[model samples]
Target chain A: MFKGKFVDNLPKIYGLYTGGFLLFFLAMMVAEKNGVSAKMIGILFLTFTIAIYALIGVLSRTMNVSEYYVSGREVPTVFNGMATAADWMSGASFVAMAGGIYYGGYTYMAFLVGWTGGYVLVSTLLAPYLRKFGCYTVPDFIGTRYGGNFARFCAVLVLVLASFTYVTAQINATGTIASRALGIPFGTGVWVGLISILLCSMLGGMRAVTWTQVAQYIVLIIAYLLPIFWISWRGDFGLFPHFTLGHEVARIVELEAQYGLVKNSAEAIKAAGVPAGLAYINVPHAAAPEGAMAAWKFISLAICMMVGTASLPHILMRYFTTPNVTSARRSVAWSLFFIFLLYFSAPMLATLSKIQLMDPNLKTSIIGKPIDQVMAIEWVKNWISVKQAFIADFNKDGILQLNEWFMRGDVVVLATPEVAGLPYVVSGLVAAGGMAAAMSTADGLILAMANALSHDVYYKMVDPKADVRKRLLVARLLLIVIGVAAAYIAAMRLTSILGAVAWAFDFAMSGLFFPLVLGVWWKRATKEGAIAGMLAGLISGTWYLIYVGPAFMAKTPWLGIDHLRFGIIGATVSLVAMVVVSLATKEPDAATQKMVDDIRIPSGKTVISHR
Target chain B: MATSKHEAHWNDTKGLMRITLALWFFFSIVIFMFGYQLNSVKVPLLGYPLSYYMCAQGSLAAFVILIFWSSGKQQEIDMKHGVSDAERTED
Candidate 1:
């Protein structure tokens, strides 16, 4: 029954994807040899992305609703895992997360916890249950489960709020990558990202998005892992042998003795240059606080991450495309397994790079001038020509001072290849991967947004009798409009990739996590209760994040009491509100109770029947 | 016949859910405690800070182990409940 005209386009789709991938690789190779500026490489990458989208257009006709949403439920679990991984990774994971580890120390492990922890919630709680309900959107789950249109409406509002905010951050990352790598204006880079997202999303719908995301995941993972492998190899070999030995460790101690204090402070040494023989293991004064307070914030952030992973709208929707509940569970296990392969390597990469920045000899070689002449030198000229500019002199003291640039966590992933003196081709691949991560996630969120707008809101809620074809058209239109809106918002605000992405987690944990979890687990949970919980979560979470979060809690706090703690607090309030309200209000009728019962147990009856 | 089959299926699902939930809760606590302990204490291993090592590397390895252990337990529960997909296919 699900098979349709679009399914026949598979061969042509394969051809287009392969051709585009090859062409991009070839173009990048040529650019690298010609000594193209980083800016030119970025422009060429954007052009290549556009060409790929055009190729997708040639293979498939204009998308209808079914094709654009859920890929008509035709995706295999393994392939879906790849697509979901791309969705899950995003530009933040691809580019900024490693940098976060570099600057934040082990504290940044919270990101991994948040991302991977969410899958556990999805697999055990949401994915299989939602699939059983046979719904296309999250609101569909709400509407069907509660037997009321209002619940669906609230679900749609929450989905849009979370997803649009999330997509804006991704677009922001794309703009940053393009401007820094290609030398284009941030606005143009954003446009480039927007055009790529629109073309990939609007043309084939979920089918195009699914395949493109799969390709993007491959590019992003390879781009992320290759540099780490190269750096590790170089470190192990004589190229950077001190990195492997305890030489840097010994030198750090020696420098402490000579300078009277550990000279690892980036700000203090910025103008003076890194003293010779001790560039590694320099802990800045700002970061060197000891005790429970440090541990408390780190642990709190990790809890937020663990809970937030499950609540993300784009990540949860991928489960709907799976063939069965069991498959959905399996896919999640695989996703986490794949995610770990890269997640573990991130800290290692950060540590290695930090060591390189601190190494005294590398600093001196790249610093170029004596300490006295260093003040007259411009920062850009010193490292632009040097092979290891990321580790070069910042203070002009002929010593390398690792301060401002090193503090920016986003550079860890971008600078890895250059840090190890790998080829420019590696950088190009990383760029492509970064683009892929952003596009894959953006496509998923845009698809969910379009579905919520067209399917749940306009059709089911507003006009139940609307023609299917017209509904499909509206869905397509909504995809384009939402994509453009996200691009516009991204262009205006949401500066850092990690910061913007983290805000989405905080929002989702606060708003949806309680409603979704309570709605699924507790039978007594009434519509009024659900609504109350959701509103409390949304208003409180948003307020704390916008007002209290930045003011009071900069990071995760101890004893469940930071900005991130608000999500748990909001979630707890939601649960209590739901229970209290449910008991206070009239119970749902027998039919609603039976519906809840059906989802709770697996009937021995076959999920599918022949005859 | 349909009623009997349905009842059996319901029983199997109940059993599986109970097992899965138990395992999930147990693991969640175990992993969380391990992470907490790692953060609170400092026992060095292999020239690196012990607590730092566990939070970064140890917890992840433990998680992978948990997945495998849970999968095995799931297989056992499926068998005991006569709900294994292979068994159903044979029927």
Candidate 2:
């Protein structure tokens, strides 16, 4: 029998959530106006928002295996889509995506296109069939479909590697946001993020995360939109942010070119008196290469990101929570729409922030001014004092030249409201949104890695007949262990946030995407083929990255592909290996073909029995 | 007769899928291959560059429409061939 919809009484839940958030927002506003210090206000905002998420996690906690693993497969369509959207849009998408565009110009649009295009592949190639298969985890699908423990174990290894990288980046973003908001050291922020992430995921498993993600979507969307809406409405763009922002982007490009030319000239470099290597600080905005080989890097990046999007285990795991195949298919559309709202606005916000940065007021003359005088301007002084953004005054000309300024891209969105002279509360709200984005993603990643370990590796391989109670307990313990490990790595700051995310996506795409696709669509695909292909992809992808990643970042391309996108080559190898090996070996048996046929149907019936 | 007919219908649906996926490949790849070139050309009325618009909003809209289209069409194909789950429930 079908279960009753959880959101059927959505009105009550909606009223409570909306009313509670409003009450909290008003309290913060009042407290700030009553002369609460900015640091205290920010701490209150971050603490309150994360606390609400934790409370939601506790309320939705469950011990039942079915509920813990996949939320009992009862989440309705609309809510599932919202949860999926929140899971898909990690801290990187919410906080750093626009900042990427701000820093890298047109080349960075690859993230938007590649990430969004990924959902199309998901709905078409993966979701419905996976839903019909009624598996609890990605590795469940792999193990059952391939009819071997080796394939399942391979999936677990790939899932852990990919999701761990992703979760670390989210934890790192959390650290940065929490540090800025609470005025604490970065190390402490990582611990705070780790505790909060474990709290949301360890107690209830997927059941807790599903509803908390819905709550997070609300917080993140509101927080993301408010400042953009403010900036758009205040600026000449009127109410719609994306409407007139094309012109703003064009203007930003123009200014970049002007500054770029000036920075590159001998006179300007001599005026700055910096080292020759450091003379060119402004990267040209329109550096899309015309050469075929160079352009291949862009194409490779786009493809890797797209395939990686569909390959992510945490994302695929969310589709398993939907009620039926029909709903699973519909849910992908909903996820796309919800994600579009933020992604569409990100570029517009990026352009607007750039315009504000280049405004006459903020770009004050520091030339000929003493160091103290140069540091007096509020934005300049704050950034320079913290060394977050710097002004070297290399010429000691006392005037701030464009080439003399350097600001990190990650600060663009966080500093936008400040640059626009918005109220201090807006910055606090942005910080909360950033936290929600990072925490929501962290919750999903930790849960996926835990489920893979407990279900695929431990339950299936180690203790095949373990009771649900034992399995669930093991899962919760694994969640806590993984959370601490990822947090420890995040605190070390081994890689930049965006760079780490790129690695995670590329690894998943290379190792998992093709195998999963071929496993479903190709009847000729054998168990040996799947296993060999996966191992080949993972080893080749990681090896290439380790060997050539740094040089690729320095603008040297390996075989016309950036090191970040070497996954494309790895995926090609995977595809070819699967086909060649599957042909060399015998086809999958008739029963396996029958299983594939059974899964391809949109029937509500579960063909496979409970593990 | 009925089983063989079902086999024929499944094959036909598979054919339709190939066509649809080909279109998706074109949009995801061919469009991206020319992304820079496309971006250089602006849409007159929209005042947005083609590549920028496509990456930002156009492809998303296409994806939403494509999923619904494929899902709906696949359902119709199943129903017409007496292969839908609803047919089983009726039995």
Candidate 3:
């Protein structure tokens, strides 16, 4: 079943991956032990990545063009799915998502809903249609459908904007991972991330990225799952046998009371290195309305997440890799299955960690320790390495107070190994996995950016006479430039991995989702309509986020608006614009009508016969 | 457009779409209601809040169920309508 020419190349890719992983791990170990700064190790890693990527570029000069671009399109479905999974995971999926859940409580589950549900829409609605059109890029589909150079240019604009925004987020996440795990300066980490992007994208286009992403996906999932399982085993050896019962309310309530927890003890428990317990008791100091509005906000966030996942550009492109429509559908299903494997466990682990932290005994032990000191003593020192300690005595009373900063959201995945007290090796593996997730996504976004520049703009729009070889050359050159540009942007702007990712998703939902969905499903959707809708969505959504979302939500009461609500408003505006403009414009001609007809009909002759 | 033999099958496909949409609506409502009721349920699993557990785990399980049921039903409907590739070839 695994037989393929690419399988022969597996050993080579594995060798490179493992070697790179080991080198980074050993360097980290030495730095942790010898009092070498994390910043130094990060700089070293960055320098090493750049050198390796450059070497690959020199070697690729001898390689054929097809092999560089799509790996001859001979990849097996299962392996392709794994690579696609890696691409989908991103730095945000590996680190930020878990952290968000750990910090935001049940509200963060919106991401899981949006992300997974989007796949269903892809498989059932969009994937098969796009695959049938047989395009190399997303812009290709738009160009062919609209049959105009202007249409192609608009597609390119959307593609680049979406991709550059996304690439910046990936690089930002890489910086966070490097700075936190290796103790590198964030700026230096950005430089390293840029070099890794250059190395991966500059060598062989889709061909190289696909195989590398598969390898990366395996590493990321293993890294994410292993520590959680290890911690679960350590925390309660009988936890598994009693998983069903242990997850129930009475047992949890009993555990909370046994732990002597106060109500709304999320912050306190996290500081104490105990899992959060659900104590129904009231904390008189609990902030905000403790009722329906809170629940409505949660629901609204979920809606935003579900809609946003469908609009992400890099994720949409994976459907193009398969041979035909059926494979695309099947591939999406497989992607969901692979994603569900980790997604289902994430919340459980978060809850369990929360409960462990809230235990009264652990709380007492943590009372006098500085927040950082507590984290170092209970988590970092025991599991990874305790390089230094910074404990804050906030209360002024001989005891140190534990607050929200001790449990920053981004720490969920990184702290998993430490929370469970797994071996140093596990922590090392998680780091590699996080890098893989970040790099795979970075590679995809860079490729999309390159394609938009070289194919859509240069070849298709600016000069239709551009030769194939020239187009290919431009694509490669653009890939390098975009990678560097994205890294620079990431270094200069943005903070926190998850924050950047959330902004990217919000942008996609607001600007792209409504236009794309309507363009496909609604016949009256004119090109003018689509263009106006995109612009309106981008402008209004951004304005609301910048001016309204934070200001009113933070300072004023009953405004009842946030980032998620901004997305909904943006989508609504886009829909209204599309409908109004379409009504005022002429209908599509016969040829355009034919294309729509073909999209709806599935009863045609087989395009790719198995026999 | 000329009427083709496939015209008869269109209704079936439309019916399938209706059913799928209905299933989506039904499950969404059920899951939401179930989530609301979870607050009252006292049962726990693995030291987690049971209500929270239902919100995270149980709702996801329902989503998976909705996917399978809807897709499988669509396939069956296609077969019955003689529109499926396998069914057409058999005929």
Candidate 4:
């Protein structure tokens, strides 16, 4: 699979990714070393990054339905793994993740564990079987597994709802990247991201999207690694950040003591746009409470993340592009390897940023010093001008206090290069990297929603006899519609990237997890059981979040669990509903049983016997 | 006779799945849920606290090894039972 036609094209793509990065890296360096403005560096980086991904989309252009749908199922394991990694690491993972850890502290490692562990679930439980089924989308699996249109429709409903929330996160990330990188208004920046996303996904679908994602993975990983590498070397740890980050963590703790701050706590110092009351609740450094309630919440949030990762529509669709069931499994391992390169580095980045932040040399004026005197630092001036970070003398003591310094979590990774006094081009590179992360995931998500609409709704439901061209046309149109709608939602930007992602995961884990896991593993799961389980889960999970969440968070917790962890409740309801319904009703018919058995074996492809 | 052999293979597969899934649950959920205790006992191998090492890198490494291990083991089982994808797809 790796040696023939595909292998021949590998060098050219690899060369393009590496060579183009070097070329741009040099250009940005020389421009910055000269008298070019910082804003120009940002604009240059954004333009080059978007152009490279857009070019990949153009180069892989195709009108064939199969190619548009699943890259014609010919993608090699390595490339598919790379593409999947790119798709998996969204803007949230790239930009906000480190800052999340910085702000949320040790307990927040749940996001890391949940996400990486979920890939294991994919390779072991879901990906190989789905590939064997040779289905077009998640709904196709459900529709066929249960032998009913109602089942298919329900799957489509969950797919659209979950993928749309997930896509809006990606678009929201894109807006952040554009606003930071191109120096544009966030609302207009979302449109820029939308246009770039449309270019990569609208015409070429999965085929174009996959190759573009591979390019994007390369850019994002490099963008992510270089600044961290620079920070480690500057800190005198040499180039091995992973091996030496532990020492840095110890030093940072020591520094915290020196600065009269709480040891081992990255407390939120600045509250931007958050009310004072709500701000206090967002503190990360409270003493660890070992109550059962805390333990349950921790376990529930982790489960929601893991289950949600395995069941996400766009991530699952990446497996459908692999050549065979084995490749699907292997591709998932490869995805983990690539993702680990970034995920493993994020905590270290957080520690390093924290160290830079705690440096007394960079500290504002001491007691009785004027606030204006503290504002003279270059990085302080830059960040304050942008309003992304602040160090106010809240006590009017004429001096900066430890708690007086406040910065947004999302800006930590982006601002690390600058805060560490690295070259301005490196900051630009981080912005570009953040853009790649956002766009690659957005491309995959838009395709997933469009597939559910065009394949499941339009082709299967509206026009069962539609031709390939017509189906492709419908997909393209739906991609445009969903893209714009998602962008508009992103422009609204209701929540933080991590918050939005958690909600998306909650929806996916609660509503889709049982149906997906059961469809492959259990033959007794009837269509009726599947439908009832999904709706019960969806309605209960969403209803709690919309109606009871605020009151629940503000007052007494519902059943002693917060709204962020409501997916646990939803999953429980879903599991009970599925089991009871399956027991009360007839099992799946013989054909469906055979389908389940065949998927388990992972041998010859299961033909999609259309009803 | 073939049906009985296939059933035995299926049983073996199920047993293997249970063992692997147990390990999965421990690393992914159980360890994190009870991480407070482990986090307090800081084993100094890599200069960071033991808890930080486990949280940041160790769990992820275990996940990678587990996936690779499971995939390899499943392939062996499939081949031994003569139900490998190659066998099914062969003309």
Candidate 5:
């Protein structure tokens, strides 16, 4: 009577997981009641959740190449959707995005639109077609379609550059979060997290990674929603914060009026008969570009992110797991929907966190208070002790004035529960969720880069006679090497977590966007043209970024185009190169044109293969 | 496969692509063109500046709907041209 299939048993398994999670939540609360210290609670969360992930990794370990490289290419639409969502919402999105909106306000919304809107491109322009191609890695597609080893090598080089930048950003987030939870220094925390990252992905391969990501997504989505639900309910903002959140936003605008923080911090408070005070305790880097420049940056960043989303190798790779082209399209839709659940609530989370810290009615309010008294608040005491926030009476006015008080934007999401007077258990949950976000993203990126290098460069180019086992071994070695290098770079704290991530998106879009798009849609695109585009875009973009910004320590942005939006320059130049070169050179043969035509069609057996 | 049949289906798919791009551009770009000015114009019911509300909340929801809708619509176009995977599986 109980001869149920594995797919039928899936719901039962996840149901049991949810029940176990609830019990753990209660156990933590009970342990706190029994006088367990908050530090132990945080430590318990860090170890417990990661232990579960590690266990999944260990259990899913495989030696099979099909299972390792692409999960045997049979993942259902829904699970792939969940895994893709988990893959997409990295530490930057789950933790830092709301904080970005909290401090940067409206302009940062570009990230939300750019990120989610990119799915439209994915379903229409890329994902479904990639599934039809049926390649193991992106460069595999470039090699076969563009008709040369040199073109494929260029694709791998671009993929490594983009994915490596992205992995470092994810590692930076994981390290910061590990330090916070373990009570270790940031540098130590990063290394500790790096060991766990390697342990998790090194054994599992692709199929196991896919399932582990789904489990992580569940923990992550729950960890994300509870604080927002509680905050909105406490603030009397109704259950649907999306609709009622404007009430809180209206208050923030009024608060901004009182502070006069930005030149465009909405209308002045004097118009509403409120006195404008010195805007102490304000966003330090809140100088938004003025008028026309603001609009330009907003559109440019959104365009860059959207293009990058379509071009990101890891995200595109997820589609190859879907059983067929139709599911690939459906998977993109569901992935966007799952991601929407968080991006939709970010503004409310940002507003709620901001209001809690500043509103006089809330007990957590700190600005305009006596410096010593503010320090005595338990949340302040906890965070300040950990160095997430700081305050001092620098002017000797005995008050924590604006510049004298500072908090990292990274602290906004993690500390919101404490800032709202919730139990310590909630903070632990948020940390687990943030760590999962970082881990899942880092896993995908490290694996994508390693797979491309080993499959495309090592096996296909360096040693075509290598067997599947040898190729898999080389991939594992590449994983360790890439993971270690990324961890070291991340420890340097090159930039804010969000800034680094945005630059990665810019890099991916700049180097790969035109070639991939035109190769599929425009059959005339040739090997030489693709090579020219990738080199011109990648080289020009990287040079412009370091020349104008902090990574290589230079200054002076041309036309006020900051380093983060360097994709605008790189992609534009790349498109021109590809078009001009393709027109000037020989058109591809009929066989290659027919290959492109087959990719565009929805109904097809796999047109290309990689082993 | 008939060459004319492939060309005909491509034309239909291209129409759907145009519609998707138009909406994507609207929600992500056009609405935010006059962002600073829109900050002064609050949504009467929601009480957020029109630009801020659209950027943070509305555009995301629109994106979710747009993708699902386009996916479903594309399937119909595929079925019409006899190019869908479902048709292949049945054969």
Candidate 6:
């Protein structure tokens, strides 16, 4: 039973949905085997997945404000975990993770550790307390906790800034997958992504987004695991994939010595479509800092990601859907478990796929072959035409050396099935899964941003008297508007998908992380302190990103803190400002302080006194 | 709101978090700080380089376990303190 007392057999429902999706996929594969073109299969994958999610959105459309905003807080722990995993995975995890590791090696391992480690903080420091506080949105928590609109208003701004950056990256990823799979233009692809994302979230809001995300997570995890399993079996990767993954890495290290390839460097592999040659564009921060700075940069980046996970509006919003504080705490564990399936396998996929390309003993070996022959391979040509990979005979040698192959780290997962000679159905399945990953993230993000605007701003501040329908209408309209804006930014292709995502995390980590954490733990934290901290963090982090980043290139990194890890600086400034300011000022009133103390208990009813 | 039982519950929860977070930080962060150094050690039977396994796989798995342990334990503590939602509803 949901919090609203609705009764339904969720596992049975989703089980059938997954079964139907797989059957439809098999039927499409059979169609492909008969006479259908690859292009037709691609189109079917994109359309069918989007159609299902859109149908879910339409079916779940709600007029009730509470249900629309937080799914009436009745979501079961397991389902919420699935939805949160889907929401958290985003385009960055789905498309770029395996590729990021493929090129960057151990350095990109930070993303996995950082991303999952953040959930520990979520379970312990935030989720249960936030659920007890019972806010519809993150900004709602800030506004209520600090006892004013100004603190809430600052949160709203940060939410917009962080979520917009993240949503744009998700849309950007969808565009890339769309173009590569269907041969559609990237520009056209983003708009399609926007329309599909809006179709789901614009109607039912969080209720639709939550259910849709659970379905998406299922597709994405299956899509992600299938190719890894397929290629592992083909290559005899191992009795268990994890053990063989380590062996494969050792083999790769052994081969690197044999083939004169440099170890632990993207420069060694020459990752394609990463904008090394684009003079006008800012250098996408895909290069892993190695040598003396590597360890420090890794720790700092992981810290940002860990903090960002606990702070990101869309992710934290999922916990609010749980039935109780205990469920909220329990769901974060489930969320971590679900996300781990992909994180553990991403390294395995990176290893297996690289081994496939690296080992001359394997049939799929492309390197060490003549350049002309390698270019003629079908997947290579398709990836090139889609602007995902690049190659050149730099030394005028006919042989394709390891350094000659260049590829966007974003497409490795998408391209792996075809590269390993899996069936066309696997490729179709991967594309749909990639879409589910991207669209689920986008829907959650767009809903978060719209809720910040419509719920936190319009309903709470500007028009407190607005009725349910009016408030929801405003939310729906904001979703479409924000979706289109993110699509437009994504179409520009300003930075790599992972790079933009890092920026979004830095924004969340900088501005919201401390305020939210401190709010729950420290009853003495005053209203003025939260506002000061939020502003200080927002300004400092953004300032550092622009100043040291490719935008201006005016200053060198301060204390090894680059544009990619601006959150460290912002968060440090925020912590100081908040702590100093709070001690300088009088503590919050007794009633508010009492409410804060009660939120820690995680029993009884939600603390709704702020209303 | 600041009753003795409520205060004690908060104190107990804090103790649990301190322990949980210490293990979390050790696995997910402390190991990574000495990342390259840890790469020197490899598991014998499995052949996983320790640092690589920890960074890419082990830490993530540890996090999942840590979360479930903390939450399950926290729920027990909540019940013991008579502040769990189940206890409240039963009342």
- RMSD (Cα, Å) for all candidates, in order, is 6.1, 3.8, 6.5, 3.5, 4.7, 3.6
Query: How accurate locally is residue B69 in candidate 6, as Cα lDDT from 0 to 100?
Result: 94
**Docking quality tier of candidate 3?**
acceptable
Error (Å) of candidate 4 at residue A149 is 1.2
Model 5 C-alpha lDDT per residue in residues A463-515, reported as the tens digit of each score? 99998788889989999999999999999987667777888888888889998
Q: Which residue ranges in model 2 land beyond 4 Å of their true spot?
A: A1-5, A261-281, A284-289, A361-374, A394-397, A551-556, B5-9, B82-91
- Measured with C-alpha atoms, the lDDT of residue A183 in candidate 6 is 81
Candidate 6 per-residue lDDT, tens place, A268-313, comes to 3354333462111011112233355778888888999999888899
How close is every model to the real structure, measured as TM-score?
A: 0.81, 0.92, 0.80, 0.93, 0.93, 0.94
Tens-place lDDT per residue, model 1, A1-611, is 23555435545654566566666777777878888775567667656655665455445444455455666566666677777888888888877776666555555665665566556656666775665555777777776666578777877887888787788988887776766566678888887778778777776767777777766766677677767777767665234321242333334334434433333455655554533322222342112235556555655566667677777777877876665555555667767676766676666666666556444555422222344443333432433333223343444455533332223355557655765676667777788778878878888888888988888899887887887678877888898888888888888864555656676776777767767776667767788878777777878777666554665445544364665456766666766777788789888877776666555443233222211
- Candidate 5, lDDT over the whole model: 0.82
Stretches of candidate 5 off by over 4 Å are: A1-8, A262-290, A394-396, A400-404, A551-555, B86-91
Q: Pick the candidate with the highest lDDT.
A: 6
Q: lDDT of candidate 2 vs native?
A: 0.78
The CA lDDT of each predicted structure is 0.63, 0.78, 0.60, 0.79, 0.82, 0.84
Ranking by TM-score: 6, 5, 4, 2, 1, 3
For model 2, how does the per-residue alpha-carbon lDDT over A1-611 read when each residue is reduced to its tens digit? 22465557654685688778878878888888899887887898899888988998898889798889988887877888889888888898888887787766667777777888788788878887788887889989989988789999998999999999899999998998998888889999999898988888778899999988988888899888889998777665666877766666666566666555344456654664443222223544433545565456666777888899999999998988876777787788888888888988887787777777564433433433456765776766776566566666656666656666666666678778876777778888888888989999999999999999999899989998999889999999999999999999999988877788888888998789978988777777888888878888898888777767874435455686766787887788878887788789887888898888777666537656675
Q: Each predicted complex: what DockQ?
A: 0.23, 0.39, 0.25, 0.50, 0.57, 0.59
Give the distance in Å from residue A242's predicted Cα in candidate 1 to where it truly belongs: 18
| lDDT over C-alpha atoms for residue B49 of model 1 | 41
Question: Highest DockQ, which number?
Answer: 6
**Model 3 chain B, TM?**
0.55
Residues A38-110, candidate 3: write the lDDT tens digits: 4555445444544544454444442444455445445555666777788888888876666566555555665
> B1-91, model 4: which lDDT tens digit per residue?
1266566667777877787788889887777666656665555666666556666888888888888888788878878887776433211
**Error in Å for residue A347 of model 4:** 0.6
Q: Candidate 6: deviation at residue A214, Å? A: 0.7
Evaluated on CA atoms against the true complex, candidate 6 attains a DockQ of 0.59
lDDT head-to-head 2 vs 5, winner? 5
